[model samples]
Target: MPIIQFQLIPHTTQDGLPYQHLRFQITTEDGLMEPQDLKGLKLPENVQWSQGIVIEGKGPIWLYGYLVHECHPSSWVGCYDPRLGIVVVSSHTHAVKVGNVLPIQLPA
Candidate 1:
């Protein structure tokens, strides 16, 4: 399995509301895949979006907001098979910066 590196980028909306942009990169046998950015994901209020997390197959990865969210939502960002080196983000957006240095486990 490849290493999935995740980052949360802080940004301000036009209305001045604070939110985070989620970005990730895959490190596979070939090399580091291009970073993928996922915008407009509604994260939980308790999550601190300043740090990055890495998921290395210790178990399944789960996302949450008010409820348990899907990791690959059809509307936000599509599902990708990291082994194939194919990255899929929404057609309207492009990949953003690399993530933070901290390594933490994603919420189960």
Candidate 2:
């Protein structure tokens, strides 16, 4: 259960339209990145279901989104944006801050 932490970077969709749904580009300190295709991505249960409104378009969709983002056994993950509620782990191509606080999962 090696947990690896990363940051979530928000971006506009390809169409340049900003729709709902937590979107991000995952990245790591060692330069490891991956696409969090929820369809096949084996992320934590907390990261999966907490995407949008439980009823989906029912009560009130989340303004930003989940925070924990997404993850896989690869040790990649994201967290609730302390700034924005936007969830969805990202893998962007930016130099991970020199000392960004991140979570570290234990080895299984």
Tens digits of per-residue lDDT, candidate 2, 1-108, equal 222232222332233422223333333345342334223433223333222211011111221132323222212233333343323344332422212333222111
Tell me the tens digit of each residue's lDDT in model 1 across 1-108.
Answer: 335454544543233433334444444555333323123433334444332212222213332221123333322232223353112232222322222122222222
Off by over 4 Å in 1: 31-46, 49-108
Worst 10 residues of 2 by lDDT: 52-61
Instruction: Name the lDDT of candidate 2.
Output: 0.28
- RMSD of each candidate? 13.7, 16.7
Q: Give the lowest summed-lDDT range of ten residues in model 1.
A: 96-105
Cα-based lDDT for every prediction: 0.31, 0.28
Write down the lDDT that model 1 would get: 0.31
